[model samples]
Target: MATRRKEYRFRNGKIIEIEENHDGNYGAPGQKRIKKKKPTEEQMRLVNINNKVKRCRHKLLEYFNAGDCFGTWTYSQANRPPDMKAALKDFQKTIRIVRIEYKKRNRELFWIRNIERGTKGAWHIHFVVNEIGDTASIMQKAWKKGGIYAVEIRNEPKVYDEDFSKLAAYMTKDEHTKEIKKDGTPAKPRLKETSYNTSRNMPLKKPHVDKLVRWKNEVKPRKGYYIISIHEGINPVTGFKYRRYTMVRFPEPKRKVQLKRRI
Candidate 1:
């Protein structure tokens, strides 16, 4: 007994808004506080897994670009000279070739710098260049080009794995893994950030070569940041001798500009 139009009529026997039908939504006139229903356990798990996959993919791609050889760099304090800017520029110039080669070989290089402390204790960048083979040679060239004695050494490294399935599988079905509400329908899993950080082989600690000295007000300005005037132990690897002058323990805040981005 119903016609084509009647078949789509509302229960109240009124024709539904043509626009609402096309849009799949009725423009409700009143304010309605629609509380987002909490996701079921399975939904949450799926979301978490999805997030995990995203993070892993991101990191894997980053590693691929940087060649998975990321680490902080350090040079001998004794090798530091009167000027610090000159040293970094020289080193950068030497490193430029490595960058070029990475592109030539279709590899990626990612450099990250954390709380720099080189010849001048300035912020230094750490990178994971795409090509792994030429690191030693590049460092040697940087040393020669930099003309600075502080050796270029990598420290505190972390590598990313490309195999996403294996990397993702680790978080499967673990109750401890947290989840996020995904944007799309029936939100799929997205891995938690904490889980990713833990599993990605990320370095838990940073290289801290705090040159401490006990010079009473004798702290003098060196290359870039003011030097604490260290009077101490030689590095086992480099075998460079630091002047026995005691370093001034400047408060942590001032240390950055006062003694950052050195070597």
Candidate 2:
């Protein structure tokens, strides 16, 4: 943090401008400065683990949203390169029965995939094709009979509120924060590290270089924790003002890129 000293450089008394050093945002921090509280050793380890799990979870969710019946089956061939065409072929074969069954019985159920980086050095799925059936044995037999080892039978564990507990376990369980020395109650909402854009600081209303550009092009800026550029929530539904700054579940890059040189 450099001090802004009022020193006059007089060639003539017109006006000379000087920028404060470092500006508190950019540049490397040397040993003299400490930015934030140093977390405990345990805290750092847990944070690293959580970040990995979160990344894996994103891929898992992507598979489901792309018309996957159960999150259990992976598009990637067990540690081998993904054969999407083969996966889709298998998908078509599996769902043809499902679609036929649906028409006859109207099963509008969605599947939930329980995935983990397996001990066998392959990503595995404990696929429950749909939650609305006792079809575990049926599906397992079908896959084996049709030669798809990737589709396996791993049902919900025998625990109270089986499905709910699993989801809560993932969502609620987070890394421990720095242990406060004195008595400090854990806050209501858990803390999670998020991708923070450097454009987190809001621009003051003096026609800042950023705001002028945003206004001219009429692009929306996102909200919350901006240091440089601005953000406005652009909801296709009720619109930005009615919405809240969304939780950072994925990496959204800060748009502080300068394209002036390219043009």
Candidate 3:
């Protein structure tokens, strides 16, 4: 088996994944292949949702950085849309206005949006958008029917790794997971729907893959970068060890000013 590695570089950090490559042929000639059981429908659903979450996280890290805004937007009682369709339409309209506002200032808008309904059937929106000079103000003015509550993303390595993972999980949370209602009774999951959306301006870079030649046993950081986290697991199907880690550049120190002695 050949060792393979993949490297993904983002705006704030980088991820490296390494694993063993198993050839497509499962067995040698005349070898009886064991038939694996097919995945149940529910299992397949969860797998798909998990994949969506990973993809969402990758995009968020690739395009967004510190000082960006991440928050939820809700509609007033009177302005609540009747259905998901209407909610999406209103959201699209609002974003279109936001894009125009950014364009007017010669800034390009990059955003990721997700829409979901609460147990009571009320709809709301979650978003991650690049912060310009007037992002909050523009969004607030454009979304007249709702009040936008936003918080700025912190300038930290964890914000790009752990925090982004949490954000992406929430934004892409599927309706397939069973949950308890407020009444303490098990509630049925809602119908599966779209996971999330990204603006066309987002640019996703392809990861570089090659034969694994370094860091096979120990997770080490590069000269100018530091490791944020490392995860190790075994692939059930392949029975091979898998490892992934994240690295971020060290922040440069501020220049010190020297005081001059007067004669």
Number of the top candidate by TM-score?
3
lDDT of 3 by residue, 1-263 (tens): 34567777776344432223433224334575435556677667766776687677777767776678877788889998878788888988999999999999999888888887766666678888999877878878888767787777664332344527667766775566565689998778763443378888766677777774333567678778787767676644445456767777778899999999999
Across residues 38-122, which tens digit of lDDT does each residue of candidate 2 receive?
Answer: 5677666755654444333322322222122232344344433243344344544665565456555665533333333332434
TM-score of each: 0.27, 0.27, 0.75
Model 2 stretches with alpha carbons more than 4 Å out: 1-92, 114-123, 129-134, 145-163, 167-263
Shift of residue 157 alpha carbon in model 3, Å: 14
* RMSD each, Å: 29.4, 20.4, 5.0
Preferred candidate (TM-score higher): 2 or 3: 3
Write down the RMSD of candidate 1 (Cα, Å). Answer: 29.4
Per candidate, the number of residue pairs that clash is: 41, 15, 0
Question: lDDT tens digits, residues 1-263, model 1?
Answer: 11011011121211111100111121223534333455677667666665565444334332333233443344455644334465456446646776676666676554432123332243233333333666555544545422221222223222232222233333222334333457544433332111112223332221123322222333343332233223343323222222322112233454444656767
CA error at residue 48 for candidate 2, angstroms:
12
> Each candidate's lDDT (Cα)?
0.35, 0.32, 0.70
